[model samples]
Target: MSIAAGGFTVMEAEDDYVEYVPVAKRRALEAQKILQRKGKSSSLEEDPEKAKLAEAKPSLLVKATQLKRDQPEISPTEQMVQQEKEMIEHLSDRKTLMSVRELAKGITYSEPLLTGWKPPLPIRRMSRKQCDLIRKQWHIIVDGEDILPPIKNFKDMRFPDPILKMLKAKGIVQPTPIQVQGLPVVLAGRDMIGIAFTGSGKTLVFVLPMIMVALQEEMMMPIAHGEGPFGLIVCPSRELARQTYEVIEQFLVPMREAGYPELRALLCIGGVDMRSQVEVVRKGVHIVVATPGRLKDMLAKKKMNLDNCRYLTLDEADRLVDLGFEDDIREVFDHFKAQRQTLLFSATMPTKIQNFARSALVKPITVNVGRAGAANLDVIQEVEYVKQEAKIVYLLECLQKTPPPVLIFCENKADVDDIHEYLLLKGVEAVAIHGGKDQEEREYAISSFKAGKKDVLVATDVASKGLDFPDIQHVINYDMPAEIENYVHRIGRTGRCGKTGIATTFINKNQSETTLLDLKHLLQEAKQRIPPVLAELNDPMEDIEAIASASGVKGCAYCGGLGHRIRDCPKLEHQKSMQIASSRRDYFGSGGYRGEI
Candidate 1:
């Protein structure tokens, strides 16, 4: 017995007038006839047995359509229910349809019906207790009219199941304060400015929402090439951009398993091939993690545009402005013709940054996890007064006294190289990085240091901004930063994520007069014990401001006397001008007027 054409079973006898042929042979014969449209005879015509078998076969197309295939048995009622679901999904809007398809593909979620694919919940009013809870418990203060629902945990939040699962897999059992508060505002489609400490899990606060919003918008309408990315993340350094790119890539793994196509996340940074980057943009991208310099270059070459971009984020925004990226950042914003949601995250918010936020963000809710520019409460700070000639001796003592996994920060490349060389001569496992080194050398130094191959890493301000090295036991400020905000960021490398660490700084008389007053106050605020030497120096900035205020008339700055300006006073004119010119000459000598005060 054999199953033949149309799934019919037949019992054949040895002498019966029946010819048997395989289904594969019948299809091949039909394909031969179609290919030889010229009516040329094939092997079947030349062979009597094959011809007889071919003649017994039915039309190949009819046989293929009529074949009964093996399928799971489904009851009539169950089949009717599945058909109804298919009909509803087809009639729904694009986002709803996509949601249904995603559910069928194993992406689980508990949110209610999607209203035309809109976010699960709209902006809602909160009670007084809710507001106070966010402020008092989480230390997140909001300053805007946009109300937001409180997200107590990931399970209750409106995030897609794939993102939530990725979070769990990443070992994030609880939401950081920044995430607990910032996620709700951003997911509600409101602009936000987040101020938090280093290693505070601020990256995921915006990244999760950025991906979700971009994907949702893409489902509704596809993005066009050269119209810019759906989401743009700008940082100050190439290293920081690369870190963000890796994080986003990690989160996208679960989404890929849920039958969603892998998104194209591009790293648009410098020190790479520009032509290759341009070619990538020519195809398309969902998200772009970029540094200001390379992104500006791409825009100038017309390789990319941001007219249709829907979401924009600036990580370490204060550092970006300080590094003279203010103009480039503004230029990038000029191309946004459509409405965009902007988010700014920084460890500190200076007055200039506040002004920038006021202009760039539209009624943004300000979220602060701690006081701006305040050192981490978990870090123990210490300062030693060392002369210029004896600084290296003191640094050697500190290194010998401290444990492994130490980071040393220098003011310039010259000091970085000198310190690294001295450490190598002393048989210390160390590596160095600065702006002067090529990209490959910098990357290798960082990698070796991260892998524990090098115990100490010496670098300039390039490493001060956004590099994350886990378990950094101590930070040595070889030279104190010129600005107070920078000191906060430099020492942030240690004492991260509530882990206690130590930071030591070398202070000379030159820094004592300018930085001591501010440093003293900062140390007191962070509850660190202040050194008697630093507590004795008076704040020069305060004295200067007091002198300016006491002189009520147009007078000489040096003598604070009326009726004579500093430039015209015979007693101090030449001396004052010479002093001003001397300071500028030494400070800006290498770069000339380009480094003006």
Candidate 2:
């Protein structure tokens, strides 16, 4: 017997074989046969009647009109390729022109520092006495040579029209004290150490100048791939870094819409994928806002460079040193290939930070808006002796004292979570963020709180430094922090941007006497009502001026605490003990003499 399957003949017998084809192949063959039959039927010469019927009905396999052979249809992928090729050619021409300009100027493409930069004539023409009167009125103390006169109006700065418009849009009619003195110094390409209270618009002091610097560089020569970041802002925390990055973007957007050259800014922080940041760098960026850890990692990995980064800003410099990011920050300085303009802005100026600034900055100007580490006068401070066990329960009453968008700060991550959970269970709209939470969760909580979707935000010290929350009515310290600086920052969150705010701190006996004394002094300095518990704790540094003059440094020179002198600073002792323990550990690792051994 013989059998045929899919056009292949086979013999089925004692020594015969049969063959079969795949179902898909067989179906395709059947479809081809059908198409052949349809083609034969569709021929007008073969069947005129059927052809007329086909013309009346739409044919499935054939088109009524033929496509022109002169112009072929291009696939989406091919079109993209053509466009990319044209872009590459255009970029090449621009690069050639840039190279020629660089050669003529005897400078390299990576170095974009604008030498001999000067402020507008209006600023330069102001006499020293006039500058003094303005600074005195604003309570601004500037220590530097050839200080530029402070601009009373934003217009006097001679900023681009778009920036002025943006200022107007943001409802910032006049510059703050820091912006008044700090802006002119930085704009003049001078290194500066800016000391101002929290919520004093310090961010804008550096941010606006950074934008201007980036714009100047971009206009002079476009940034090529992996070539720039003319401006660099290093913040202590990821939240602060993101905030600064957003501010830069906010300014950049208007400039771009106003038909200015496109300037790119990137946020390089931990918890975000480094690949995305690397991709952005590979393209190019005009400004970079970053935290120390991630920025150091990127530089160490050679994924980014500061070759053209002439403008460097350190926001919350004291906090950066306190968080032990000082080494990472100094290491970053080693990566800069050229002389850079350094700016350090912080609410508190500790001895460590001052020493660090002296070593890092060159001929730096000191712009002090107020006494360093002093409480913000704009904030009304309230101290209550609430028991530690009853704080969570009393949190409800505190929330009521303020309107929506209140910040509750705790010393520990566990407290933040507990407070957050308790609030949620009690039907309070709240969000919590801490170092232990995932980055996405932290970002979500912050965003939700900022967007006014949540009434209260429970957070640790992570939100304390440099995270601006506009219109924050109150800041409640659930637990008094051990460090006075932390207390200052926690309260600073509410009283920001020239707005009056209230800060209520819950204190108990568990808090060290030193901390209590510091808080007492802070409250007294701000002229807030001090409770009996704090009032009874006698101030040890009654003759502070004498001590300050004797020590040649104001406050506790070691820790920047106003309540105690350097000799009595608990923080200094703790640091010394920590160093001793660390040394012991190293000695043990080196097989030194041990009692157990």
Candidate 3:
């Protein structure tokens, strides 16, 4: 007997009993038959009524219609106009949202995607209102063809997300005016000269750009330790360099990760072990913050090269020049490639600085935070005409009334030591530093002062510039500097970061006579109150305008005298003779004064 399957037959066993197939095999055979039927079903003719019924069946989706159609039978033209109005309103909302997002991200909108829609204008479209705003709000001066990009906040500057996160963590939410205006100029690959008060966030102006440039370069071509650093920041002092290095490291935290190649910044300053610096530098560095002396030494010793340096910045540039590093600065500049970007920052723009800038920078954008040589208005300054012998007593009295974190500046190392010893003897914790001290000693003194382990710091002019101690309540000029510029820097040590501070200067006729006229002018310019003696000593001839007005003659502006043009002024001739005599005196003094009595 045989059991018939679909197009096949299964014969029974020889015992005449039925032999069942496995369950799986039976199901497989059934599936094959179903697939055959399905394949052949299309070819076989179907009923037209069934096809019509299948086609008539609809999905669960409902047809769309106007919701208010039941209310009224409106004209087609009116409906078209209403729909157009609604579409326009929707488009306007979308455009507004897009504009806000772009503005926040410091991005300009692209051309419109739709046929009828127009692209929004730039939010920073430099209008007359914005120009007036900048002029009125800041003492910004632009010399190049490019207009500065205005920033209302850090968000408007469009810093990287990592940087922004770091800034937020550091509690820095807004960009200072200088940072806002100057960072854009630096990032634009142009040389810039930034003049702002000491605590106006000038460090970050170049720091942000340096980090951004490094990150961008790293992404494109991985930075290697062998090729040298991509950024070089030159500061006037070792402490300033170290401070800048710390700030860079703080900003670099988010860029370096656990498993990634580290982004390194090295401080190649003196006082530290050179071998350790050389070792780390051999490994690689993305940035280098260094002093002129140490950096020049490294360059001479062939430890570093500037061929790969794309960005160079000078902090406290005027001080650097005043420190007599002009030749060294020029030598370092020679090492850099011509295509490198140079940025200079100073508290004041003097003739020497202007000349150096003209030679060193290429079409630099000048960013002045306040007046070019203006002092911090936040500082309350007073002058005391103490006799030279009475300064210590006066200083002791001032210290009795003032708070800690006070900085005392002297003229020489001996004065620094004397003041420090005097303060120590008087039961005041004090530390002193000067150029004469060893590097380790200077470092210890500064560290002690910064850690609040010492209440007072006595130092020469070496400590006057670029050392940022945040909570200094007072700056005491134990001995006034001969140049008024140095005086400006000295007093600036106290009033920083918008904090109210007091600066007291000890002035006397014998010691401060050379600077008395200039000091009076500076104090007046800063709007500080003068003592009776200082006010009495004010030179009438110093004010060219006042003297000229009083003289009632349109005399030479240079000399402020009658019957002399600027070119033919007797004072000019006298000044020329004095300069010649001074140069001769210097020459003879250096030559041991051959014919001196």
Candidate 4:
């Protein structure tokens, strides 16, 4: 049988339709028939005690009124006690109890400030002319109030005696431009965003401040088990995290030998046994250097936390954002239980990164050693127009241009392997690293190259972002990267510590015209000798300056690519389409509209 209801048809068996009755009505009809046939009392009627009890029960409104009258008024103190009891019960979990105990201990403990520690004196005390001259001499551009004077030497900063000795031991007698100005801002407890050339001692700018913060916290109140990470340094890659961890460890050794409070630093990164990291965290860590993925995992799994983390540093900030770690970074921020001194250090400050900084950092002072994205003046840049087929053959000649400890960056892992094997066949001491390699292999390659045991290290852009090889004499770009920002970082691997180095790049027809244009501009800006091929390609946007003036923006504001204006940016368009596709997919998947109209 078929029947129609609303706009759809319904089919049922013939007997089902005839015999079906509403359940409520059927129950009532059966009760009536039972009364008629056997004259039996209903269950509720037969239970006299239950019926009487039901009659005695008051209505909800009456009961609520009675409850209000029966309860005694609680004093504010008694209410607070109740609240405390409830909170303690809620936080009875082991992890939360540990956090509470550490917080209580931190609040109760007190100690004198370390000897020789003093607040940084303001630069305003100096004559205006002297201050101007000092900034000009160091090429330091600072944007913030009451900026501290640049330190002439390590002593001017008033570092502890052990730190001074350690500095001298490492042959670092004077502060670099960024360090001179940056150290004071961070030590003063102000947030900062530091921009400088890749090899301009940017690491020390944050690393030293991190050590100082961790040391102060430890002295004031040592962290208990499962209760720290007083200072946190988040890097974008495992190699950078390892390097930063090592720098912190090196600084800690001197303080330990000087009989200071014992402080522990932990390296949390992927491709290592998580059990080991958990074990270290359970013991307690004063400082943590980590990449985003493993750090997020540890935080999510309740193995570690940032309840006491008072200092946060994002090294290679631009690279982190570019590599799509921004969400992970924000998620990590959610784990922080209090305000922290945030420091963002990077070689390039693109518009996207600048926006991210404004949103993430609080009233940060920006210190720029040179114009953002500018090439290092200390490096001699050479560009060659070589055919794609002949590029591999010319690699041998390029290797001879520099001494041992040279870095070669390729765009692809397969190319890195090819070049590495080719160099080995020709009896060159070379090592290669890329994402394809395991952690142990990558670490060995980097360590061997840094130790000068390997004459050349070939790798992808993974090595280019923020890996510091202080003795590297040359950097060769096996292929120009897709973005101009990457090209800047690639060449910056050399020419560190005020020492001059060389950068060589090979270009061919396979490269894009936009990239060639950006390279031309960069070479022109750096005053390097431009190859004939790059010199001939004219920028099609002749009215770029006028357009920028009208729009109140300069360059490609989207991706910060210098090759094209915003309207012509391929990356911008690609990102826009991707966003649209993602939104559409989300909409359809969310069941917004799936059926035909």
C-alpha lDDT of candidate 2 relative to the true structure: 0.81
Provide the global lDDT of candidate 1 against the true structure. Answer: 0.72
lDDT of 4 by residue, 1-597 (tens): 688999899877565457669999999999999786564235548889866776698679989999999999975545544553343233232112112433455532122112234444654366767866988999999987656666677776767888899989988988888987888778777778899988888888888877888787787888788989988999988998998889888888988999988889999998899999999999989889999889888999999999898888889887886665766777787787766778888888865566556544556788999878888998999999889999999999998997788888999999999999999999999999998899899999999988988899999988888888977888999898877888898889888877899999989988888878878878887899988888788876453555555544455655556667655666545556765876898978864322100
Can you rank all candidates by lDDT, best first? 2, 4, 1, 3
Give the top-scoring candidate (TM-score).
Answer: 2
Per residue, candidate 1 scores C-alpha lDDT tens digits across 147-249 of 4655667766677788888888877878888887788778777778888888788899888887887677667777666545888999988777888998998
Pairs of residues at least 3 apart in sequence or in different chains that clash in candidate 1: none
Q: How well does each candidate superpose onto the true structure, as a TM-score?
A: 0.70, 0.78, 0.71, 0.76
Candidate 2 lDDT by residue in tens digits, 21-110: 999999999999999887875476688897778678865444424434445897554554455345334423432211232335554332
**Local distance difference test, each candidate:** 0.72, 0.81, 0.70, 0.79
lDDT of 3 by residue, 1-597 (tens): 798999899876587667689999999999999997786435434566655664476333422233445468865545544553453344234322112323355553222111121112353576757765865676665665554565656766666677788889977887777876786677667778888876778898999888877776676788666567889999888878878898999878876742434678889887778888888778877889998878888889988888888788989887775555655777786676435677888776553355456544556678777755567788898888899888898898988657899999988878888888888998999998887787788889988899999999998878877678878989999877765556777888887877888989888876544356556666777778867876776464453444335433233333222223233444335546765876888977764222100
Give candidate 1's total backbone clashes.
0
Any runs in candidate 4 off by more than 4 Å, and if so which?
A: 1-124, 548-554, 573-597
TM-score of 3: 0.71
Candidate 1 displacement at residue 314 in angstroms: 1.5
TM-score between candidate 2 and the true structure: 0.78
Residue 443 CA displacement from its true place in model 4, Å: 0.9
